[model samples]
Each structure stands twice: as C-alpha cells, then as structure tokens.
Target: MKVLSKSISLFVVCLIVITIWWIGTDGFTGFTQETARVNKLIEEKPMIMPITLEDSKGRMYTFHELKGRRLFLTFIYTSCGTVCPQLEKNMQQVYESLPREILDEKIMFLTISFDPDRDTVEVLDTYRQYFGSDGETWRMARIANKLELKELLDAFGVIVLPDRYGGFTHNSAFYYVDENGRLTNVLDYKDIEGAQAFLHNELLGSEMK
Candidate 1:
C-alpha cells in the first residue's frame, strides 16, 4: 500500500508540472504569433497619411505633396545636444554624397522637430541655419498640433520619453520614403552607406519601373 501511494504521488506531481509547462508554452506561442501579426499589419500600411503640417517657414503642406520625390526623413529637436546633432550631420553627409541631379531634382531631406511646443518656426529655422542646411533641398519642420504630432510619431514607430535633463530620449532612425510616398525602408541614422545604397537602388528601380 505504501509503495502504491508513493507511486501515485510521484505521477501526480509529474502531471502537474507537465500541465503547467504546456500552458506556459502555449500562452507564449500565442503571444508571439499575435505580436508578429500586429507587426505585419503595421508594415503593410503606408508610413504617412495626407495630414497637413507646417514647415520652418510656416508653409503648410501634406507629406503626400512630396509624392514625386524620394524622401529621407529624421526626427530631431533644437534643444537636443546629443544624438540629434549627430543624426543631422549624418544626414547631411549622405545628402552631400549623392549625385547633384538626384539631390536637386529627385531627392529631398526633412528634419522634423518632435518637440513642437518649444521648437517654434523661428527655433527650427535657427536650428537649420546652425546645421547650415540648404533650405530648399534640406528642410526643417514641426507638426504644430499636439494630437497630430503623436500620430505622426506613432506612424513612424518613434517612441519619445522625457529624460531627466528635460530632453527627450527617442528612437533615432532614418525613414526612407519612395517617390510614391510609400515607406520603403528604414535605416539606422549611423548607416550612411546603407542610406546611399538604398537611394541608389530605389532610384535605379524606379527608372526600371
């Protein structure tokens, strides 16, 4: 009787452990699948809508208006003393390296200030001038409306967190939009070669098309 009772207890413990393991594994798998599904949905959608925004010059235009030109865009704020400047510099280098025809006629660069409250038109203009950005080819702008700003950041997958120093800690990346205004590729801000290659391929592919 003692032997039978011990055997039963061991089986029950094993059964309990197996049950818990199965439940945990199943839940994890489901969560992973859901996450992947959501990511796919986001990837399939266009990066920007036709929402109108104000530029540093206070000119109103929708991103859709830029449909005929390839766009390289990044998020930045005038107050940022760290990553934003580096990002702008990298973008400038990429812009300078590209063929003048592409730079002049086919491509454009945009630096958008996420901190709309503080980064007014004057502030953005000063920031652009500080970077010595050519106002025509390289433009700086900000979305003035708070709600629209959040929506734009979310669309670009940019997460902004307030740092201890009253600056922002945000996702830093270059968003490459095709001539048709589709979000074709996203590269790290540090990847100057990658940005160039992407542009080359995109321009070539568009020519072929």
Candidate 2:
C-alpha cells in the first residue's frame, strides 16, 4: 500500500509540473517572453496611441501621417553590439525578400531607437548607412520627446531598463501594425522565415512571381 501511494503522489507531482510548463511556454511553442504573440490572440480590440518620431535624417513623422499604410516596426540602439545588429540584419533580410510593388506603395519599415539621448540624428544616420539601409524602404528614427517614447514602448509591450554595464537591456521583437495603426501581430526577430511568410501573405495575399 505504501509503495502504491508513493507512486501515485509522484505521478501527480510530475503531471502538475508538466501542466505549468506547458502554459508558461505556450504549449512548448516558445517561452513567456512571447507575451506579444499570446496577447494578440487574447486582445479583443487592438489599438495604438498617438506618437511622434524624428527619423535619422531629422524628419518628423506621426501616427496620423503614417495612417493607411501597413508598418513593420522594430526598436533598437545604434551602440548595441549584440542583439541590435542581429535585429537589423533580420530587418534587411525581410526588406530584400519583399517585392517592389509592396515596397513602393503597400508598406513601410520603421526602425525607431529607444536610446534618444545618445542616438542623435547624425549618429542614427551613420548607423543606418552602415547597415546599408535605403532611406525610403527603411527609415530609422527616435521619438521626439520622452513622454511619447514611454507611451509607445509601453503600448507595444517593450521593456527597456538600464544595465550594470551602463547600457540597456530590453525586449526585442518585430512589431507588426495594420493600416489603421492597430497592432495585429508581434513576432520573434530570429524567426526570419516566419517573418517573410507573414509579410508576404499579409500584404500580397499571394506570393510574388
């Protein structure tokens, strides 16, 4: 009887652990950092707040101005030696994989910097150039003011915190917004193939020839 009870208790504990892990990792699809993906499904109404940004060239753009156009947006800091470079590379890959028709009129790629104080217009422009960014296809920018920057980051679920190394530690992902300025999806930047498929199908419906 004692042996049977111990076995039953062990089985129950194992089952509980498995259940917790499954929920935390989205059924083993990914980890809890995938809140953006999980949130999309649960979000009854998706919306974006009014925000303004200054591009690498010192040009201003706002939510109102960018309406009626789908946007592929990401956040980064030019000084980042690790994750940011990979994110930009992922952006470049996605941009190149796009069709001219979509690039010309359907969508825009916006890379906004969360590190405004350190990333000036000149600095951002230089960074963009280093990445071989075509100004029209990809416009890197910084929020004009602190208030709007916080709002934008919070709304998109991006968390930026200073690290011990006098740098930042923040969550990174590809934030996808629809024409009406509502966030429709958020994908991991490392998932290059998924990003391409999502962008193509969402914009062109059928793949370009």
Candidate 3:
C-alpha cells in the first residue's frame, strides 16, 4: 500500500510538471505569432513623406530612399543654444540602444538643419562630430532656403521662431518613420526610454518572441 501511494504521488508530480511546460511553450508561441502579425500590419501602413531635398553631401534624398528602412528625423540648427542638443542627445541614446541588425538592415537617422545660411556643410560636419556621427549611415542636411524649410516644417506641423538673442524657439518633437517610410509616431525630446523601446520593438521587430 505504501509503495502504491509513493508511485501515485510521483506520477502526479510528473504530470504537473509536463502540464506547466506545455502551457509555457504554447504561451510563448502565441505571443510570437501576435508580434509578427503586428509588425506586418505596421509595415503595410507605412507613412510616405514626399520630401525632395539634398543631404550635406549634395546628394538628393527623398521619401523613396526610405522604402526599406525605418527612419528617425528631427530639425535642428548648429548655433542653437538649447533644445537641439538635448534632442540630439536623446537620439544618440536611441541610436546606440538599437540592435546592430536593425541599424544595418532597417534603420536610418536624418537631422535636417533649419538654419540654411549658417548650417553649411562645414558646420554640419562639426555638429555631426558632437553626435559621433558616421557620415555613411547617418546624415545632417541643411535646408537650401527658408521657404523650403518652412514648407517642410509646415507639412510636419513643426513650428520655429527666432528669439531676441538670435536663438531659435522651436517645437522639440522627434519623428519616427517605419520600414516603409511611413511617419509612425512623434516622441518628445526628453523621452529617451520611451523612444528607445518604441524603436527597438517596432523597427527592429525585437518583440518577435
């Protein structure tokens, strides 16, 4: 009788272990499937911006260049005393935390300087160094004129004004574009972690179980 009771107890314990394992496996699989579905949905609805502009290297870049990659964009000028630096710093963190595969395979970063007259290629090069920018992968382009700058800003609903001290007063919003070049979300300049996770999970497909 004692032996039978021990055997029954052992069998019950094994059965429970197997059941827990099964549950865990199935739960993980479901989560993976859902994540893939979400990414596909996002890709299907990418935002396409019709920006026809030149980079610091004088190469023409537009919405078409972003067809197969995610993009992070913001407006800044080299001589700004505030806000622009903070936005660049936040972007650096986001860029660093991104997986190399995503950075290589699915991501691009663009910082277009709103001050055309001042932010020449030389100034952009200097500014890029402050952010440890590698010219091949990342870019800081200067707008050709105030009119082009205003049109782009208006299209994106970003506003800029000059202060009494010749400084810029501008909205600090970081724009996120998806793999299909669709503008997906706007992040605050200080929201580093939120932006990090947002980019990591969506652009890199990190939540792909």
Cα lDDT tens digits for candidate 3, 1-209: 99999999999999899788667556344344333333443445445556666676767767676677767888898898778898898888888887676677777888988888888877888788899677656778876766767877765666678889887887767777766666666676687999888876786464475
Q: Candidate 1 regions off by >4 Å?
A: 1-42
Error of 2 at 78 (Å): 0.7
Clashes of each: 0, 0, 2
For model 1, the local distance difference test gives: 0.80
Q: How close is candidate 2 to the true structure, as a TM-score?
A: 0.82
Q: Number of the top candidate by TM-score?
A: 2
Displacement of residue 146 (Cα, Å) in model 2 is 1.1
Instruction: Supply candidate 1's per-residue lDDT for 83.
Output: 94
| Whole-model lDDT per candidate | 0.80, 0.84, 0.74
Give per-residue lDDT, candidate 1, residue 97: 76
